[model samples]
Target: MSTLSRVSNTMPTSLSCIDLTVTGALDAATVLGIRQESAKAATDGPILVLLDVAAVTTVGASGVVGLLEVLHLLRARGGDLRLFGSSAALEITRLQAHLGQVTRIYGTREEAVDGGLGPGRARHLAPGFRWHRLFPRRRRTLGWS
Candidate 1:
């Protein structure tokens, strides 16, 4: 039995995709392995690989970097990587990493499977939106005290 099981979905979408359920730590090696598997699948044609991480036991910076690498690799080959599932560790990593794969997360399998081509499309800000307002600027002043 494979640690990551295939999740077959029979839905019509613009993307040709494969759904895999992953368990345990989502480390770099695992992500790289997924990239290799995705490469095999891409032999048939371009595909969007979706990983279900609900059962992921743990996550760290390496995992985040791996995800970003895999994502870029797939996309470069006319494919993509999407992730869905509920795991506190994944959420924490996403927020803390603040790099890639954050917007790739979907709340539910349905949302992920049925989501549109654009990841985090709705999350994009409008033109001229002040980021400082949302993030708050750090204050600094010259003082001798």
Candidate 2:
């Protein structure tokens, strides 16, 4: 497994951009490192986390779940997490399909940062809010009804 490196930059009071470049395989250890980096980047005030994952070569299910967890953490702290990478990245595309409403994805870092930092772009949900709450209930078919 290859290592993941994260570099963070704090923008004037409202945004903290984290560039994560991961090479080789993205495994549990690399995902943990990313979570730690995200925690370190979070602040007391409302902040946006723009993650640049353009350099990541391979990603696993664990990596995706880890990122979703990070996103939840940031949202709970009155912030949001946005991912930017090549549109061809299968892992990223899959994630976008599943969590697009809760998380934003962009094709380029500039686009991600711009969208993430834009006025009224970040959806600040209440702390401890669950993503499932955003969706309406589906009618029971057979078992639970």
Candidate 3:
């Protein structure tokens, strides 16, 4: 079985920023760890998983699928995953293997981090702050068939 390990730098305080350096095969086990780590970071603020795929020259279909699951899970939990330092050969292989669609591609770590974690912008759509257009229902659909 393959493994996905991360060494990260983050603010100790809750509601801050996190930067994780992902390495290895990035399989299901790795995906679970990443999800847990990201969720923990989200309690403070956005999390960034900076995947350094330079060493990972090849990835299997399961690995790619796991990555896609991780991306969507992080997004749903208000965190993100980004790729950095991937080789051209890897890029071509990723495309040829039809795994590119599963993950967002970025040229630089800075760009990925900047794009995912918004620099200094407030989270406007937080819980308990409902939009004016989405009105509350008068009658609740409680256990209706």
Candidate 4:
């Protein structure tokens, strides 16, 4: 006689892509990696930096702040960083909503890779992929600061 045992587990997929992983902590090093990879992609044109934050057990304020900086840097350089499989989208959204135009959030890696930010359009490694701002800038006391 034999008895059957049921098992349940969660594991990340071993998918090969232009992807990066961050866990436990996100800091200057993470930003550096993003910069290096983005610079390389700038040369190639239309670089997609997919960060898998699904396993991020604890994302501190500083870490989230660093992530914002990295995202801004990529956008400034004509590249982009998209959050893939982010289980903590709520936290990220809250932290970045105030910053205005932070990282472009996506539900899946496929959506991010497909560049599905706009309506019924697919952007890839092609020309004319300019980063469009979702909101207009507001004039501040420093005169559009």
lDDT of each: 0.73, 0.65, 0.59, 0.54
Candidate 4, residues 41-116: lDDT per residue as tens digits?
5675555567765655554566567777767776676667777566564355444445323444565766766556
The alpha-carbon deviation from the true structure for residue 9 of candidate 2, after best TM-score superposition, in angstroms, is 3.6
Model 2: colliding residue pairs = none
Give the residue spans of candidate 1 off by over 4 A.
Answer: 100-102, 116-145
What is the per-residue lDDT of model 3 for residues 13-125, given as tens digits with 9 covering 90 to 100? 23244555545555566566666776666676555566666556445566667777767876776666777676664576567655554454556565555543557753233
* Candidate order (lDDT): 1, 2, 3, 4
Error of 3 at 86 (Å): 1.6
Model 3 quality (TM-score) = 0.56
lDDT of 1 by residue, 1-145 (tens): 1256787866655678888888888887677678788888888777888889998888857778888887777888887777888888887777667643235577666566666335655544333356687899888877955
Question: Which ranges in model 2 have alpha carbons more than 4 Å from their true place?
Answer: 8-13, 91-97, 116-145
**What are the clashing pairs of model 1?**
none
| Ranking of candidates on TM-score, top first | 1, 2, 3, 4
Error of 3 at 21 (Å): 2.8
RMSD (Å) per prediction: 6.4, 6.9, 9.7, 11.8
Per TM-score, the best of the predicted structures is 1
Select the stronger candidate by lDDT from 3 and 4: 3
